[model samples]
Target: MVHAETVAGRRTGSPWLPFAVRRLLGLVAIFVALLVVSFLIVQLIPGDPAAGLAGADADLADIARVRHQLGLDQPLGQRFSDYVGGVLSGDLGTSFMYRQPVLTIIDNRLPFTATIALSAITIVLLVAIPLGMLIGVLTQGGRRRWLDTGFGFVTGLLDSVPGYVMATFLVVMFALGIGLLPLFPPAYTPRFGSASFVLPVAAIVIGPICTVSRVVRRETAVVLGNDYLRTARGWRLPAWKRYVKWALPNLLTSTLTVSGLVLTGLIGGAVVIESVFALPGLGSGIIKAILDRDYPVIQAMVIVIGMIAALINLLVDILLGLIDERTLGGSHVST
Candidate 1:
């Protein structure tokens, strides 16, 4: 016999449907807001895009002609309407500096940024998860207060350092001081085989590792305190089976949610890290565009970053719903 709660849950559609729809709507709203804010901010920046395109030595008449040609002579409302329409139609327009389509420039540069971001995330998960699990297990039972305190202190210290500062430190220690690696090479590209990728990935990984580990440790500690965990311990089950098969699954639902946020932050961090490492990625491209006041490139980059972040959050939400039935608005069933 189906319960009333079950019927209500069914009537609401797939348990995750409402949540997914809400999140999707929110994501669209955020993207729209970003577009408006980016457009307005670019307009407020000094120097005319038309003038910039016309060249410094070009006289007023030449600038005016360039503006008219670029449709900048239109009323602000019409120009913004066109800009928003272009965004909706997936036409980010052309780059004033490169004379190439903005999407083309982004496509060319995306792989490098993606490689760095993925590498950093890989390193973070590989190192942080195991280390955090170990710390959580060892520091359980509240008997070893010092161990927990020490771990917290270390992670806190690491998190306190900014990405740029950490990048500089890594460069000084590994690249310049020890003379161990090349700082810069002519026409460099980031590939998996290159030794040059290390410092930037390392710098990007540091804070995330610290932050993720702390979250995992806290969650693990909480899972350890659960009544079922106590019962499992009383039953004399092997430590590995108890923690790995049982405790870890519960910890992951929470840990992964935090990891999604961390991953999004890594995208922003990539900009600074790429610049510091002098990598030819979107981050460096963004810096150059900002200096040149290249509106199309800047707006496109912001939107791309927002989309990536929103997708990550969506995936994380779905995963959480799958892992914990209660999160899908269903009753939790204990096996």
Candidate 2:
């Protein structure tokens, strides 16, 4: 989820260089580990990819040629080395099923996924955080206990519902019954600006917002009880000034951490939403690759998603450290 910047006592510590470098190295290790797992998973699958490519009627010669073309004929160690080298050099190889470069396929499909994910994240933060703030304030009076209880009940229900189920409900309400929007007809070219895109994006957003708002509400309530906040109230400060100058800075860290988790979850959870909406995005690409047994696309997608998630989490950590000098013990701020 995305968040608006709030005024805070300037963040302290050199959190950028060291934290980012460490995160990059960690991401490299994760990539290498994921590569090994991917290779083994494919190797252990019931059927041979080479034979799968060449049909049941094909002769040994055809299978051999297919194996050689796919580099399966090489010794396992040699193939592993080549795989690692190719990955390091950004040559993830071509897709046997798509008959296209893996990079090309990713380039063609990534934007739609990015757009949907970004929009969902933005929407979640827009709705969830403010609602959380409201919940936090209400809880202070002890007058709206049901408000939190009601929100908790609704969030639990939403989280329990499958993403596709939610997407279908939205489609039925907006597209079928009311005819207020198009039903995402097959082969439809996805455009972010289209009126039809809202429902699908909203489908992705609702579950995450419900989850995040709960956390934000709890954290904000805690932060409101901090010493600085208590002191601000003791001084009889204006409400708006107190929230802006004291309460928000302390609460920013919670927002960053929650947003990082939400973004990471979106990468994996977007598949059902993407398929339901017929959007040509990374989630759909992954489903297509799995059905076709396109190893290259699967491998590349896994690595890319892992890296993006790692980078976002690392950014959150660094920002947290920068935002609160106590997080760094005592140091100059990083750019």
Candidate 3:
């Protein structure tokens, strides 16, 4: 009979089960860290949540009552304990500024943020992958020096530009300068169906497209150098088959890894874009909350955003493992 340790040591069987369990634990660790960091960071910031909630005219008794009501008057350890308990029990606390439950506010605006973030990432994958692979195929073996030079310069410039700045520039050019489009569409909430949705999504994707495509191109160039690819070339296989069949499968691991990381970052970018476009989403809400020193709203926002990011990375990690089972246990895959 095989020992359980020996069976485990072989590193064979369903890949995702163990991977999912491990990453789920990692998600817990990340959640705990986010809670601690968010709480501590807010504490470090100047000003008082109670004072903001009570208003300038509020007397000492009013501030004291508000503080006690919000549990701010409790000891630090007790406050943290209560905060953690509230989170585990699906209580995100109430927003002092909005005078509503934090989850309710997030629930209302979350769809907008989700739409923008998901749409931007989807575009990045669709555009960047094909564009990068095509460029990589074209520029292999140091061919097309001028095209390569131009590509590098262009993508680098675009990648360096932030999403908010990109949004502003596009607005200035299309709406304000050329008079082709309507001015910033922040008047109504922008959704997937609205024409107003175009600019913000465009802004978030532009830089990420540049970054991902460059990575893909570099990976493609490297993949072209492998022995199997050389053998394919030896057979004088057509360009399309050699790359589409031989190269794409290999490219999945790296592309997904990079795109997943970019996806998380796109959440934060969407926040900036939402504000620039004047959308009523988490971005605008969080900015207002910060200005008001609304700790509950800030913590809730951080938690929601952090969960989205963690989930994205977890999905990516699982995909990478599925694509290449060797990645199931990073730095510890038994041969």
C-alpha TM-score for every candidate? 0.90, 0.86, 0.90
Each model's lDDT comes to: 0.86, 0.78, 0.85
Residue 255 C-alpha lDDT in model 1: 93
Question: Candidate 3 — worst ten consecutive residues by lDDT sum?
Answer: 182-191
* lDDT of the structure predicted as candidate 1: 0.86
Mark the regions of model 2 whose C-alpha exceeds 4 Å error after superposition.
Answer: 1-17, 185-190, 328-335
Summarize candidate 1's per-residue lDDT along 1-335 as a digit string, tens digits. 46765755554335566676788788989898888887787787788888888988999999999889777799988988998999999899998788889999999889889888888878888888888989999999886899999999999999999999999999999999998877657576657757878888889999999999999999999999999999999999999999999998899888988898998899999999989987778899888888898888988887887787788777777788878856655333332
Q: Higher-TM-score candidate among 1 and 2?
A: 1
Off by over 4 Å in 3: 1-11, 182-190, 236-238, 330-335
Worst 10-residue stretch by lDDT in candidate 1?
326-335
lDDT of 2 by residue, 189-240 (tens): 6676677678888888888888888887887788887888888899999987
Rank by lDDT (best first): 1, 3, 2
lDDT of 3: 0.85
